[model samples]
Target: MTTLADIAETQRLAMLSLSQRMADFETHLKASPPGADLTGLHKDFSAFKEHVWGVFSALQRQIAELSRSVDVIEMRHRKKFLLLGGVPESSGEKVPETVASILQSKFGLSDLAPSSLTVCHRLGSASDGHARPILLRCADSKIRDLIWRTKTKLKGSSYVVSEFLTRQRQTAFTTARKLFGVTNVWTMDGVVNVKLPDGKRRRVFSVDEVVALGVEHGKQLDQEAPPESSSNRKSATSPPSIRSRRTIKKK
Candidate 1:
């Protein structure tokens, strides 16, 4: 499997190669006699520059493809997980029971048992009276999907449930929302969906895709990113590591 480390190393090597080519070009420029024939040297330099550009572009394309592939896999692994925000936080509360109560009361999943949650807990520090979001791993993906679909019932409530997207995708989702308005932009199954003003629909994966669809297609970048009144953020740069939090076993 291609890891982020592998991608970083690939980029480092590509940059190193480009740096060497630059150094070689400098050496050639310095070694040329004061009044050497200009035509052949210019032609050679042009060809060398194009060659380096081609290499760099190819490397960039490869890295983007690799990152997308890794992102797809990571989201697939989180298929059974869901993020629940705005629940009241308390000291040493029973997370599984609390989450189950929300699922039962709010989402109309009354029949859903607390045991269905393989893992559940509040995320991050409890400082400043902020309610820490809960991360839940359902025993079945179907239940997770059901909860997400019924999220509209939470429209007026303080609670919200969202996809456990990777940070890049989360940013893309938020940027799409800012550009297109919250009504036109949303995430479905971890893919950011945007409805353009022209009545066209676009699904974006990365932040770059979001920028292209929004800023480039709609208007200028500076004009499109809406002002920040409240920093409404979702997810993180990387998915929270669940290995240590996987202590719960399904009943």
Candidate 2:
């Protein structure tokens, strides 16, 4: 089984190789005398640089392709799962039963059964101010899709249904919505889709892709640092001036 670490290591090795080649080229350049106008050396260096760039670009492209494939496989495994957010919490609650009830009473999935869920539980601790979202893994993918398609029915209710996206994809979805507006951003089958200003749709899979979308749409995605608090700030005092004591000369 191939892990993300394996892909990362492959890319790292490619980078290392590129760096070594660059160092060799630099050494060659330094070895040449200042007055030596060697046209052959210049040609050789140009060819070397071009070859290095070509190889590096090819390796990077392959890495990106492999990453996309892995992401697709990982996301496919989550097709039967949906995240239920904004559901009120209770003390000593039965998570699966509560999720079933919410689906039936709130989302109008009256036929959804607690037994249909292969796994259902709150995602995180209830200590956070926000309600802990329930992760519902349905036994059937069709039911998950049905629930997802009807998520619009949750409007005005404190509920939201979303796909179980990977961390990279989740970040991209959030960034796309922030940059392009929620009305223009959405996800379908784990792919974060953004509707550009020109009405063309773009799919983003990572934070970098979302940033590229922002650049394409002329949105300033650079985050400005927050103002530092001045409550405990002390005044900047100058260092104490050292007085040069001159010996009094008695004439």
Candidate 3:
């Protein structure tokens, strides 16, 4: 013998629970950094699924309660009809697309700008283990800096470097990989083209790619310069000894 008031109260409670669950999900999403490990993302999405199911359950109960509250049978039938007409609770299909659409609609395209895109074309080994496309956003400057340092360290290598401007960093990397048979891709602050040893070409990040190219340049310089023998090294090292002897003589 549930009264209309009781039904209304139940609906209110369900709405409140839904609101709280939605809030919690939002908090989790906000706290998570972009490009978080895929394994961790699976866990987050699992929780989100649970919360969404909870919301659907609550809403279904609310609808049932509202249908029960109508005095007239015809009126109750009409209400039921309206409820049925309403969007059905998701069966969990197209979750990614739905979420992406919602984000795009709410925040617009500009909100999702990538913080950095780095592309490494050559990484020491013949396999080019480090050459890949990398895309990172949100406080990934440390990774960018590491790539930059690596580039600078290898700047004297035998490579050609060129920079490009483009909106899609991933596309650039894909293009580079196809062109140069690169195994890895990195996203960084900017874009560039790197020429490989086999006369192949690829798109790479400006900072790190440039640094690697610089290393190649240095290598070329070393090749052109005369090699220093042990005697030459000893001569170079003898300057301090000579200076010390001269000081002793003056004393």
> Highest lDDT: which candidate?
1
- CA lDDT of 32 in candidate 1? 85
Error of 2 at 133 (Å): 2.1
lDDT of 2 by residue, 180-219 (tens): 7656677888888888989899888988888887787688
Q: Residue by residue across 1-251, what tens digits does model 1's lDDT show?
A: 97766877877887888789778987987788987777777788888888878877887788788888888987876656778877888777898998898888887888888898887887665567676678888877788877877777776567777777876787778767767666667777888888887889999997788777765675544665443333233321123322233343333
User: Which candidate ranks first by TM-score, i.e. highest?
Assistant: 1
| Cα shift from native, residue 108, model 2 (Å) | 3.0
Which RMSD values do the candidates have, in order? 4.9, 18.9, 32.3
Task: Please provide, for model 3 over 51-143, each residue's C-alpha lDDT reduced to its tens digit, 9 standing for 90 to 100.
Answer: 877877886777565543432343222111100001112333332343233223433433433322221111112222222111111234453
Span of ten consecutive residues with least summed lDDT in model 2 = 232-241
Q: lDDT for each of the candidates?
A: 0.73, 0.71, 0.37
In candidate 1, position 6 carries an lDDT of: 83
* Model 2 error, position 198 (Å): 2.2
Report backbone clashes per prediction. Answer: 0, 0, 31
Candidate 1 structure lDDT: 0.73
State how far residue 3 of model 3 sits from its true place (Å): 2.1
Off by over 4 Å in 2: 9-32, 37-44, 89-91, 124-127, 223-251
